[model samples]
Target: MDGDEQLLRGRVYGHDHDDPDPGPKAGRTYAELVGGPLDGLLLDIHGWRTEEVDDGVALTTELSRWPGGRALYDPRPGEPRAAGPGIACRFYYSGDTP
Candidate 1:
């Protein structure tokens, strides 16, 4: 949803925040989904493209690892591919990043 966007400090992913019908079980809110849990802090990244999968996978893998942080990649086979090489998907992290 990115509705309560206020300078995201930590990495967040999946689901929308603006939607009210969270779902049958009432999924977690945007902030809670991204900022909550705080269990180990999970980062999600998806890269589209049959060939660029390797290139993008390497990137998110590096991003998720932040000394005390972790990240994961789920290409989903066909999420959304970039136009060429300088677009498609972009990732960001926080706290003493590398």
Candidate 2:
């Protein structure tokens, strides 16, 4: 389980929007920032709403972006399946899926 947990804490190489002149920098993604693996992602939307940009198909297809691994997606209501054991907290993954 610890190894699986480790999967969530990997640094990835991607573009950072906040940086005006953001060069190539490997930073931890939302999932990775929370300690998720490259593909060990968990996309949990507040409503998993349907949209032209992020439809279920598009969301599922996004998984392909992963190098080579599976993502644990949970698009439930406002609350994720399990934010954390014995923890009373909630998280919503918005346009920050990448």
Candidate 3:
């Protein structure tokens, strides 16, 4: 797919504000969020620590609660072949928190 199409389908996350480019870049890697409300969303895990990715993170979403809430997701073992290559991890939705 083209850059524009990928950008539209994926959303960047993590603490890499220092990087000049925050958005997805050409050939950049990301993790796919599976299941839950955030399903099908791509999380940009570039520059993220290995432990952080392994432990999982709470992704803020506007899908739940009046003022919004967080969706907890954990990285599953191995890459999700179904998502195709470049998708380095598969974060499965555990639950939601307000």
Candidate 4:
């Protein structure tokens, strides 16, 4: 796995029906790990791919809540071997919005 993929591993939850533990039953989500100890790392939200709107909403909302958090949405096609679909969304710690 790449750097982005590795950072996001096991950090995404609450959306996968296949996962034994989905996520929190209520309150804030555990998706935003950007400004925490993993500050310099880049996380690929796409790798956590969720078709459910609720999951997406939760992620977006959490990212928005963090002042230093940044999210980049890439609509281009991704590698076939990638964990996610042919699209990318990256989340990281950046005070500046790109």
lDDT of 3 by residue, 1-98 (tens): 88436644555554344656555555666777788887766787766777778889788877644237898999776644333235667789998888
* Candidate 3 Cα lDDT to native: 0.69
Between candidates 3 and 4, name the one with more favorable TM-score. 3
Return the lDDT, model 1, position 56.
Answer: 30
Model 4: residues >4 Å from true position, as ranges? 15-33, 36-87, 91-98
lDDT of 4 by residue, 23-95 (tens): 3322222333434233332223443434431232222323343644434322223412233232134333333
Best by lDDT: 3
Among residues 3 or more apart in sequence or in different chains, the pairs in candidate 4 whose N, CA or C atoms overlap within 3 Å are: 14-22
Q: What lDDT does the true structure give each of the candidates?
A: 0.31, 0.31, 0.69, 0.35
TM match of model 3 to true structure:
0.65
Give the best candidate by TM-score: 3
Q: How accurate is candidate 2 locally (lDDT)?
A: 0.31
For model 2, residues 9-78, the per-residue Cα lDDT tens digits are 3322243335464322223123222223323332323233234112222232333435443323323355
Clashes of each: 3, 7, 0, 1
**Superposition error at 34 for model 4 (Å):** 3.2
Which of candidates 1 and 3 is the stronger one according to TM-score?
3
* Cα lDDT for residue 68, candidate 2: 43
TM-score of 2: 0.21
Off by over 4 Å in 1: 1-67, 90-98
- Total backbone clashes of model 4? 1
